[model samples]
Each structure stands twice: as structure tokens, then as C-alpha cells.
Target chain A: MINIKKLALLIVFIWPSVLLAETMEVTLLYVGPTDSQAWAGSQQGLDEANLQGQFLGQNYQIKSVTMKELQDLPASNMTAILVDASKKNVLSLAQDAKYSQVPIFNLTSTDDALRSACVPNLFNILPSDQMDKDAIAQWQAKNPDIAVKAQAWHEDFVKFAASQLNKRFKRNHNVNMTDDAWAGWASVKMISDTVARTESIKSTSLLEHLKNDLSFDGQKGDTATFRETGQLRQIVLLVNDKNEIVAEAPLRGVKNGLDSLGKTTCQ
Target chain B: MKFKSLLLSTLIMASTAAMAEPSHRVFISNEKSDSVSVIDMKTNAVIKTINVGERPRGIGLSPDGDKLYIAVSEENAIAVVDLKTLQLEKKLDAGDDPETFDVAPNGYIYLSNEDDAQASVIDPKSGKVIETIPVGIEPEGVAVSPDGSLVLVTSESTNMVHVIDTAKHKVVKNILVAARPRGLAFNSDGSLAYSTSEVGNEVTVIDTKSLSIIKKASIDLKNSKPMDIKVSPDGKTLYVTTGRGNSVAVLDADTLEMKANVPVGKRVWGLGMSKDGSTLYTADGVSSTVSVVDTKTNKAIKTIEVGQFPWGVAVDD
Candidate 1:
């Protein structure tokens, strides 16, 4: 005979699905042209998330919004928000009373001041300007003999676009994917990972996962996480003119551990 | 009813007889070579190399000791190897990018899906997924309590250990540990668990019932990248393989103090012990060898060369 308590437990677990039917909605707020590279990159993440959702048994629907139209939408309907705008503008949106409860992902702006502002709802998937600069500074301090230089991508590589991100973007859209485009892709990927883990797009659980429980895979060894300061702690890659990774930071003794790059502790 | 009881007793005796037979052998999974190196226990020599599949990371015997389950990371499956013939038996879906797994006493395998950020429970006999419990990011290490009532999965990126209720298939508690928590082992009685965080350069001991970290232990070895940990059958000593430190640091279980660091091969990652608890083995990834350490003398007695990137080790007899 089946145990009564076991039967009761089974019924309780199964009964929830019968009661609630909800779909998570992720909003992508872009200030620029909808057809731009950054928009395309963020969309790539949404597509990847959707593909992974098949295995995870979660549903995520994306809604793209322009800056002028964001005010018209109800903030309560948004499960999560991806913001691509200037630092000041993104911070304003993060602090906006209507969207204050939503988890906001900053994809474009890399301002150090934005990170210092420490808006609880704001999350930066891209490295802050301070983080990037600190990474290079730490590397230079470690290896003083080696010369470092930066230049725009050569026309050939841009035209050919042999990198995996570039190749995938080119194959999908018939154009090279720039850094801004990759930022959009990465931002969505982070959300997708969170959704896969939580199975909920609600801001509270998603934000908790992002801040504390994320071991997000940005395709670079799966050791990425968000800092308390709202910076995504990732290794800074020093790419050569040919797009080869010459060096990576959070270099030995530059900082400790794989979870971050610089100023790891946040308030 | 009498006949059924008689038959059950006969079957139990037969199984016990089979287990009593001496079958001393050590198996090491080589990640880069995509093979398992079989070592002769008495001679401390690798007798044969059986090619399994791509990127074999974690290896262990089933609870009954009849089969070996190897986590092939690249294939996203667990390659089941028959112990008697030491050949490939079957592959079971272990979710995408399976890093390691722990076999439960109830015939379920709790597998860590590294890329998927979840733990998938599969029944080896049925080859069906029972459930997938969402865990922290980059889940790497899994340990099921001996009683089979609890499951612990450590996420390297999230730097947390998720305690799962086996029957409920849900995370009951999330215990924050050191950074980059990689490998874990439960004591014989399941009262405590030891976890290693490579980047944090520390090992945390969690009390099972409380689901809280009671102690954090570290040895004074320079550049210590502690990876896999194992508890002796007596629960007196804790054996930790320090990855880059190239040594095995033996610690006193009661006090959580380091006793000795026995030198092993370069970048040692996996730890295993003999059934009698007399000897220990370390899977050295960088040097591609297995170092046999004598528990009595606390010294590495033999270094048996194995395949490339030797990852995990398991001994069965």
C-alpha cells in the first residue's frame, strides 16, 4: 500500500502547475536604431536563451523597446530589463520609481561612476571602465618590460571576421559583430543563464542569483560572476591586432581567484 | 512466503560471496587521452589502458561495485564500463557538460551539469532522467551522503554549496563556502563533509545535520591549489590533493589541522584510497601519473605513469 504522507507530498508538488499559468517577459530597452549591431547582439543572447529553454523547461519572451516608448509600458509586466544607453540615462532608468523593482542589466555604458553609484537594481554585464583600466594597469605593473599597444581592427579582419563571435554574427546577419554587438549578446546570455538556473524571470530571485549565486558562463571557462559593486567580474583579454588573445587579466597576484578582475570587494 | 524468504537469503549470500572475492585494482580516468588506465594494486603498475571517450573527468564504481561510471565531459554522457570485462557497456545522458557525479544508494546518479547550472538525477538501469534540480552556476562537484538522504553540489563560479533534499528533489539550503569550490567528500557516517576551493586556497568542513560550515582548514603549502578530497574509512584522516602544490596534505579530521604534505606528481587533482584503507592514490593531471602513497609511512611509494591529464581515481576490490 502507498504511504499517505508520500501521496500527499506528490499531490502538493503536482497541484501548483494546475493553478498557475505564467510566462516570463524580458524587455530589451535600446536607445539606438533597432537594426544596430548592439541590438542584434542582445537578440543573439535571447535566441540562445530560448534554445537552452527547451532543456530547462522554462519560457522567456523578449520585448524590444525604444527609449521614447518605454514610458508607455507597465513596469510590473517586465520580468527583467536590459538597458543600452548612456551612463546617466541608464542610472536614471535604474532609479526610476516605476522600474525600481525590476532587475536592470547595463550593456553599453562602462562608466566607473555608474558602478560607484551602487544602484541595487542595476547590474553591469560589461566590464566597468575602471575594471578594464585596472586590469591593464595591473598587467603593466607585473610585466613592465613588455610594451602594450591598442589600435583599431585591420580592414582585412573586419572584412573577413574569422573570430567565433564575428563568424556567427556574420553568418546570421551578413555583417561583422563589433564589441558593442558582443555586449548585447553577452547581456542576454547572462539573463538566459539566470533563467535556466532559477526557472523564473521575476526580479527578486533573478537579482539574488545574479548578485550571489551566479557562476555564469560567458564562454570563457565558466568562472564569471557579478560583484557587489554591480560589475561582472570577468577576465580582461588582451587581444593582438590579429584578434589573438595575447594575455588575460586578473593575472597572477593581480587579484586573487577566478571570480573577478579588480577591486573584488564591493560595498 | 517461506520459499520467498529462502530465495532472498540465498541471493544475499551469493552477492556477499561475490563481494568477498579479492579484486584489487585501481582505475584512473585520463581527461586528455580519453581513456581509463587500469593499475594492478599489488604491483603498483598500470597493466592496461582502455580508451573510453572524450574528456573523461570523474570516475567511480556503482554502489554494488559491479560497474564503473565515467563522466565524459565532451560527450555530455556517463560512459558505463563493465567491471568484469573492463569494456564500454553503455552511455547514459548526464546532461550537458557533466563534470562529476555521485552514485546514490538508491540506484540514482546525481550528476553536476557544469554548463547547464543544474544537477541531473538519472537512473543507470533505466537510462532515464528522474529530475533536474537547478543549482548554482558552474556546478562541478557532487557528494551524496552515505545514508542517501542528502546531496551536496558545489558550484565553482557561484562559490556556494547547495544542500539538496534527496527525496524532495529541492535545495533545502545554500551554504556559502570558499572561492571556486571544486571537489567534495562525505565522511563514512555522513556526519560531516569536506570541500576544497582551489582559488580560495582553503578547505571547508560542513556539519551534515546543521548544514553549516563548522571549520575552514588550509595547509601552509606555497601555491596550493587544493582539488579533490577524501576521508579515510575510519574518519580519522582527511586526504587532500593540492593541484599546483604537487603534494597530498594529510589532515587530522578532528582538529582540522594539516599533519603532512606528501609530495606527488605535478598538478595532482584526484584522490582515492584502498578498501582496507592502507594506501592512497593521487591522479596527477600535469605529469600524467598516479602516485601511490603509504598511509602508515605518510610517503609516496610508487609513481605509476598513466595517460594524459589523469583526472579522477577510483579503487575497487
Candidate 2:
């Protein structure tokens, strides 16, 4: 004779486990080549998160798919998608995933147009570009001499400093202003550091862990955090045209930090 | 009595089912944590944590694995650890911001200091900086020539691989690579050296004999940001970790074509092959763990949790 009640309870308890045992596949849409230093830094974070074996009991098979292949991928089987910042076409992909109600995570600098135009399904794992701007500004405040010295050598130096300063002042501080590899590498290093601190890999729990626990030793000079509103509070470096780092500034804040550019008109 | 006996046997089997090999010692350099978490590979547990200088990035084991050299960026020094005693034996001052380094065949260490724009040759025995050879701006990645006669340093700002004559301690030639060149690896045969460019998203193959970039293979990782490059023991496949692409791009050494994308952790940076060449280990800097990939399957088998901000990894025989 079968014990129907006990059997039913057992089935209910084991059903989720059975489903979890079936490995979930997540596709990461990278904006740059997997080998790019900045993107590789982010990929390392995602790989470490998957290794924690927390999301689904079985490991999540992370597939690095191209932006072109995103349309061809079967969105139905994907558990989640992480988009690197370098991917210029993230907005379109986020829009496509929004209809499917799939979570789209952005780990690069946030685009305002994408954030406002796209649905709420898009979540940024990194801080906004404004945070980087603020970090540079704050650093400038502390190191006026270095800033002045860099400004004096501005013409001979490379174009990183004047452009960085102009961007922060003009309220158009895009990181693309300079060709300083150190600034770029520094940003990658910050994100990499954040990803490495992740303790768990479960999707739902990992998301929470990233949101609450993840913090980076930003290039700008202070610890950066990815806030709930998808804004990051960190330091931004001010480089001169000579390609020398002149100043470091703090950007966004959770409690005591500066507000987002959208919230303030500091420029 | 029979059921009890069966249960006992099953319990014993279950307990030993996943028993791993005795833990080998693993030293993890935590950049943010500024400490090295020592884990016994046999138990896969952190045995102890040793604090080094500020912002420890690159790490390497001596030829005998008795000493560990830690690159302390902020301090502009390399801290040497006596592995057997697990004690900080000495600190060798390199140039400014020593990021990555490689060991020479003669037991000397070559380090790339980005800020100083030079590669310092250090004699590990004396704990002294033997020579400072100016290479390029933001000199980051370094590898010793298989013959030990030369050392190559990649300058990101200059986009050139400066080949240093080990004996002369001067730049022999500046081989132009693509933009933002970083990681370097010499093939097993020493016939060719592979360099990864972060911005160019390509691997430049340099023929050591000719001292020129003989072939340039594009690593078509969508948003592919190539980091460190390592050649397999057989010297058939070239493994490159893509920073943006979140995967290890395998290249057929002979064909110089894209072979496969072995997905790994986010921002895969430093990479090493096991002594036997059966397994590949990547330091997942962002994930703060090491992803162990089976060379045969070309798939990640397990992720070993290590110290905070795990950037560089080295395997001991």
C-alpha cells in the first residue's frame, strides 16, 4: 500500500531539486572580445559567481555569445543574461529580452537613454558614468597641486586631462574622452575586484549578494558600490593630455556620497 | 542486523565518494584584501593568510616552488616568501608599480613596472634589483624567452613588445603589436611567442628566430578583450582569456584560427596550465575564484574558491 500523503510531501520537496539538478544555461552578451582586458575582467567575475554552485544545484553553463548571435539564441532556455559595457547595442537586446520578461544585467557604465527607454528588466551591475565623473571631481578637490601641475603641462601631455576635465565640467563626461590605457585598465580592475568578492552563485541569492555586498576599489581613489537604482558611487581619475594621472574624485554616494548627475546639476 | 550493516557500508561509501586528492598548497594574492590566502589543495581549505605589501597583483613560484615572489604594486617591490616556512624572507625593490612578472631559466626574475615604464631584472637570491631596463609606457605583461637568453615586456601605452637581451640588459628590438598589448607567452618549442592585445582583440604571433610578428590572428570574440595568453604543453593550441567576452578563446597554433570558446569566469586574467598539461587553471579576478578546466573536455569542471580579488595563479608540481 502506498502512503499517499507522505509520497505527495516527498514529491513536492524533491520536485524543485529535480528541476534544479537540470543545469540552467546563461548566455553572456559581451560588447567587446572575450579577450579584451576590460571585458575579461568582468567575465572573470561572472565565471567565479557560476563556480560557487549556488544558483541551480547543477552548475550554470555560461556561454559567451556574440552580439550578433543574441537574436539567434533561444531566449526561452536562458536563465539570465549578463551584458558587458562595451556592447554598444545593449539597448536593443534589453528591449528584446524585456518582452520575454528575462532579466538583463549590465555591468558596464550605465546609459541614460537605455535606462529610461528600456523596461525595468535591465539592471546595471556597475556604477553610472556620472559616478566616475564625481570621483574625478572629488579627487581634484583634494589634490589641487597635481591638478594645477597637470593643467600646466596640458598641451604637451596627451588629451586625457583636458577632455576629462571638460567632460566633468560640461556635464558630458564620457569615458571615451581619452586613450589612457591606465584609466581603462583601472576601471576593469575595479569591476574585477567586485566580482571576486562574490560569496555565492545561486541566481536569486547571487543577485542579492551582488547588490548588497559587491564593492570595488575604484580607480578614482575610493571604494565604489553598485546601488539599488543601478548607480555606482566611486572615484574617477582625471588624466592630463600628457597621459599622466592628475587627480582622483568621488562620484555617487549611497548616504553621504554625491548624488547622481541626474539628481544634481553640479556641473 | 543486515540492514544496519548495509547502512554502515553505504554511509562509509557516501563519506568517501567525493574525497579529493590531498590538498596541495595554493597561494592566492588578494588585491583588495592585500593578503595571500594559503589553501591546502588536499583539503581545499584556507590554511592561513599572509599579508604582503600594498596592492599585491602578480605572483610566481620559484623553479623549485620553495619561494613565492609577490608583486606589490604600490610599494614598487617584490616580496619573496619562503614557501616551506611560509615566512616573508625578503623584499626586492623593483621600479614603480610592478604589476606582472616571470621567472627566468637562470633563476632571475623579470618584472614589469607600469608607472616607471621599465622592466627590472631582479636576482631572487640576493633580494636586489639587478637591472632596470626601460621598455615602454605602462609595461605590464612579461615572459622569459624559452632559451632564457631574452625577456619580452609588453608596453600597453606604446603597443610594442620590447625584447630585452638578458645578458646586455638593454632593449634589443621593439616589435610593434596591436593596440594595448598586455599578456605574453612563449610556445613550448620557443619557436614563436604569442602576445595578446586588449584593444586590437587579436593575438600577434612573433617568430623568435626572425624577431618579427610573422602572423596576426584575430580572436573574434564579440567584444573580445584578450588578456593573458598561454600555449599548451603540446604547443598545438593557444589558450587566451577574453576579458570582455567572458570565455577562453582557443586557437589552433598551426592554423592560427579560432578553434573554440571555452567559457570561463568573468574577466579571466592570469592563466596557467598544470604541470602535466591535463588541466588549465584561470585566475578569475572578478569572481574571486579559480576555474579549473579539463584540457581534454575543454570545459570548466570545477571552481575553486580562493582569496579576495584573485588575479594571478601558479600551479606547483
Candidate 1 TM-score restricted to chain A: 0.77
Backbone clash count, each prediction separately: 2, 68
lDDT for each residue of candidate 2 in B53-134, tens digit (9 for 90 to 100): 7888888887655688899888888988877678888888777779999998788999997765678988888878888887
- CA RMSD of each candidate after superposition: 8.3, 23.0
Alpha carbon deviation, residue B275, candidate 2 (Å):
1.3
- For the second chain, the TM-scores of the candidates in order are 0.95, 0.89
> What would the per-residue lDDT of candidate 2 be over residues A1-267, giving only the tens digit for each residue?
369988998999999998757654333344445544345344333443343223223233346677667667665544456565543566677667332454466655445554444344555544354555555456555655554221111212323223322222123222232222222333333232232233222234434544565434222322345444544444334565466666433322323544523323212
Q: How far is candidate 2 from the true structure (C-alpha RMSD, Å)?
A: 23.0
Estimate the overall C-alpha local distance difference test score of candidate 1: 0.78
lDDT of 1 by residue, A81-140 (tens): 777788888888888888877788787777887788788888877666666776667667
Predicted candidate 1 versus true structure: per-residue lDDT over B19-90, tens digit per residue? 634458999999999999999998998888888899999898888788889999999999998888888999
